[model samples]
Target: MSQVSEKAVSFEPEEKKEKKEWKINVFAMLLVLLVIAAVITHILPAGKYEQIEKNGYTTVDPNSFKWIASTPLGFFDTVKSIPTGMVEAANIIFFILIIGGFFGVLKASGTVEALVSTMAKKLANREKLMIPIIMLFFALGGSLMGMAEEALVYVPLFIPLALAVGFDTITGTAMVLVGASVGFTTAIMNPFTVGLAQGIAGLPMYSGMGFRLVLFVVIYVIAVTFVYRHAMKVKRDPASGIYGKFDTNEQDSLLTAKVELTKRHKWILTAFLINYIILVFGVIKYEWYIKEIAALFIILTIIIAILGKISLDDTVESFTQGSASLIGGALIIGVSRAILVVLNQGHIIDPLLYQVSEEMKHVSPFLSVVGMYNFQVAIHFILASGSGHAMLTMPIMAPLADLLDITRQTAVLSFSFADGIGNIIFPTGGTLMAGLAIAGISWTRWARWILPLILIEYSIGLIAVIIAHLIGYGPS
Candidate 1:
């Protein structure tokens, strides 16, 4: 057996063996997409839609689409778009960096470790219950506040707890990801998606809460159940877990460690909870966006450092280290945004939107609404931002719904469902990619593991769209 093992190892150099298992870097893949988008600009006809501003929102005039001179991106223009994309996405990129830094300070304070250790001890035997409880909390956050990027802050905390409880990293990820995504999809009060789409569609803000609330329950239950089943499987056989056979020494230490929350740790955690409360309040009352949230986290990081008695130099170093670790993931966001720049520069986005709207108009009302949902899903591959997607597409979908005898509220619902659901699986989604990067999971592995759940969610979305159309789900 030893001779055979030696022969097998000697058959290939270690570097060659590593090369055989290569995976595409997320940033590189997105850069290639940028090039592809630029190439398509030359292939597709260029067009523009007239825009009108209403109540501080700019929306497209569906009837105003017209062919325009194609200005496909030159090589220099294509290259320049990378920096422009970074600039355009700077708000979100910085938000991610600040979150990383905040979490770093929090981690350095021993708050994360103590909390995980405490949770692991309490839920050691009742591990299965953690799935639903944790998922429900995240789902509520997503449903209420549109918590996509914010969810990344929890991945590091949960992964250790998940492993401690006989689950794997993917389960921990899904606890946050699948939960938030489902809530975002149901979107009972998600201002980023449902609210923006409703406003653009000219419906009363949050008019269809009853319908969406029902969806929230149904979809949330489905998501929690799916994640629970997977966790159970992983618990029974570690090899069955996605990413396979993780080292359990750290997880075992978390469970066995006699970790007690010191006075400082407790105070730090209290401040942490208060920070989130402030965030939700600010978002709801003050209409806080990325900038406000980033500022909040900056303050919280300082507070955490102070409460933990971390030195000034140590705090700065921790913050810098944390931010540096996430730079790769954050840059992926910039690169993904570059694809949108290329399409816009090529002037093909409007033409694609116009083509879909025209195609939907020719179908039956049922098919047309379903087609709208599917179109939103497909479009999400390129346009991943929730509010941005709504602002661009809802203007046309709302009017097209009227022309097809479908309700504007239904159009808004289709948009929310597609946009939220697509966030989990789409490659162009910077938040999802960044979250995966934080968890140290490759996008391909995550995609493979989550694909089944996505199919189920997409089916739910399809059925919901159909029911909305059939029942004339409309403004209250």
Candidate 2:
């Protein structure tokens, strides 16, 4: 849909008063759904009930509950199941805090601003090249940064530019979210997601880069085309639904302004350059953590804040608030963990895998496991958060691949496909949520436009993995 429509909703001053009420209602509904889904999923495992009878009914062992493992939960069983997810919840909370801290530093130091500005200059000048430029940026960033949060800050920066270029906010958000997601599955050297996936799957670090690069390009081409088509559609017909509720940021004007670079902005830019140089050398010379890399950003932010005369109080508050901005995204990761803990504790995960393999075994080898890519899809969906799904699926899928005679590398590639494309569909994903929030888009609106393209690309990517597997292009 186009960005110029009268039908499109605007979040300007008048809408603000009404939106607060609607947002609360929507949030309340989502919380209810999360609780209901968790409770039902936690109690649905029946296998633990069979074990309960075998172990004697009065056993008080906390682990005996097996929430999803037991088919039906008696009232007593549900009461006892609450503690099972505590650890998972804690783990997610801890990780988010650590990363959020880095975001605070980077944003305060103006490193993020500098980076976004550099990208904006390229994008604003080369409006027609937005799709490919975004695609390349996603791949390059994913390969180096190791996680997808790199896109979170940038998504906000790009949404305004997308609107200026004649696309609606939702379409803009879709391009960033879906484009980055595609990059994730096809990452060449990402340590957090791909590196972790290979580690669990027992492959060497960075072993599949050559093939993954191919995957990156293939997915990138498709995602870019999808985004460009939507952009063109918006340009052609401004009344389309895709442009609803498009909002522009005040900072966007600074990007388009032709003022001579100020001393403070220049120092901020210089700090960013030196910090990146140090970061690159660190990554190449020492396998330092990406979070640690972001530390340099924090240092630079402080220096720039002081030099820019932004005031100590404002700098402190910005750091505090910028870090706080990540809390909601972090919370989604935690909520997603609740889903995983229930699934894992139930012991249904392995049995679920066995069921999938058995079904595939009955069919021809050529079309079976690869065709049933949805099994990987399902496993990933259960652990629906991005990096979290990789951790959950890799250890399980790797061993299963061995038993089924599927190459481990090919299975890893399938896991990538399974994890990446589905995030486009699953609204629970944090990156997707952040993208929507930044662009003022809704889950309902995004799905209508992106799903068809995602499905087509998913089918093609799955076939590509199968072809790569058959051609003997992956690790043995």
Candidate 3:
């Protein structure tokens, strides 16, 4: 939900850890679901709905639902549907690639490193203030800019810094993980989750910023409070903290803290900030969609590369490398899209939707929102990639919301909060695992530490979705 770059999950038969591991590979999981969707087509009656686009948003005529001949996808068709799904989802896939490249160029220019160093230094002496301040910094990054994977690098950097200041590694690790997740849960302008979901739901990009901003502050405070309490506990009694088997001897080249914030770095960050402002204005005032947002990122990449004084060859290489890194994420989007393709071709989606409509019609509106929120939270364990989850679910959920008389924006918000909050507890989350690996904390330990907060945040997400539904959050 936060970062669009996906790292391939390593699922090699762990001869040693097989007895311990309980996770399924995301690719294998998606493929299995694709097959299941195909199988469902043969079992259920086929149906269709005539779609009509009004005011740029598309919706199905509920009364226009009709039976259609079943056209089940064969094995070859199902496999072929994967690439076709990519084609259908190309707009979102490319948007991720461009953002990856944009961030890559920024990374190559040493801007992010400088930014991190500057922040760490600014909070160096404020031992009591460190947890809240750094946590808020990351929360803002995630809510406004979608900073998940990028925040992973902070784990090692902050663990030692946190230890030196009398706090434990978990305290430092929680700052980034919890902070970024809180912002993600209350996403205001995050392109990957909220942006893509809104696009699919046919809502204006980054609309409803006001409510999200308020939620962001509330979540930020909650996250900071949790981390601060734990950090102080550890500060007072080191033995009370669960360090696991963390390797205190682990070292990194960046640990020396020599990355200087040069004037050029400041300018680059300023340009980065300005680009986001432009993106907000363009979307709000000019009605920019995916294409316009993508174009702005491309332009910003070029501008940042030039300002960073990166050589022409290096800039091109950086862009290529960045785009290449996100290939897995891009493919996940397309692969998830294929599931929809198979469902649509089988003519089963409409029937499924019809059933859902009937099933939800009698349910209380508030309970229905809560049910949707809980469903997203449960599903996030398997589909941890925020964009991938959006691609797989939004197309269906958007229309389903229309039938339930719930705003599609509410649906999008539900997905956002569900996917974002689940990441902190989901063992399958790569960034979570990576951060813990850096801190030398085990999954068991991390889960035990964060489970309470996870439940609290889950409740918050449910409330947010219910409120959104009551208020009719939407452009439609």
Write the residue-wise lDDT of candidate 3 on 1-476 in tens digits: 01111110111111221135354555676678888988987889998877766435454565677887878888899989899988987776687667657766877787665565455566555778877888888887777767776565455456655654556667878988888898789888887789878887778998888888888888888888888988888767666765543322221222334668899988987887897678667755776667788888899899998899999899998888766656665666677667777877888766765666557667877777777777777667656778767765677678778867788888998899887887788655656654554455656667878888888887887888888898898763
Candidate 2: the clashing residue pairs are 45-68, 45-69, 45-70, 45-71, 46-70, 46-71, 69-346, 109-301
Q: What is the lDDT of residue 463 in candidate 2?
A: 83
Q: lDDT (0-100) at residue 301 of candidate 2?
A: 63
Choose the strongest candidate by TM-score: 1
Question: Which ten contiguous residues of candidate 1 have the minimum total lDDT?
Answer: 8-17
- Model 1: how far is 267 from its true place, Å? 0.6
Writing each residue's lDDT as its tens digit, candidate 1 over 162-192 gives: 8778787788888988888988898888888
TM-score of 3: 0.64
lDDT of candidate model 1 versus the reference:
0.83
What's the residue-level lDDT of 437 in candidate 2?
A: 48
The reply for model 1, stretches above 4 Å from the true place, is: 1-23, 243-246
Clashes of 3: 1
TM-score, one value per model: 0.93, 0.73, 0.64
User: What would the per-residue lDDT of candidate 2 be over residues 1-476, giving only the tens digit for each residue?
Assistant: 11221112222211231223223332444445445544664544433312222111221121232334254333444334434443555443443443444444444444444444455576665767876777666657665555354455455445555665556566556656776677676767766667666766668877868878877887777777877887777667765535444433323443553434456667766765686667657665676553564565567666767766677787777666654654555455555544445444545554565456557666665665575566777666566654566654555566656666677777777777776777677655655654554455555556766778878877876787778668755553
| Order of candidate numbers by TM-score, starting with the best | 1, 2, 3
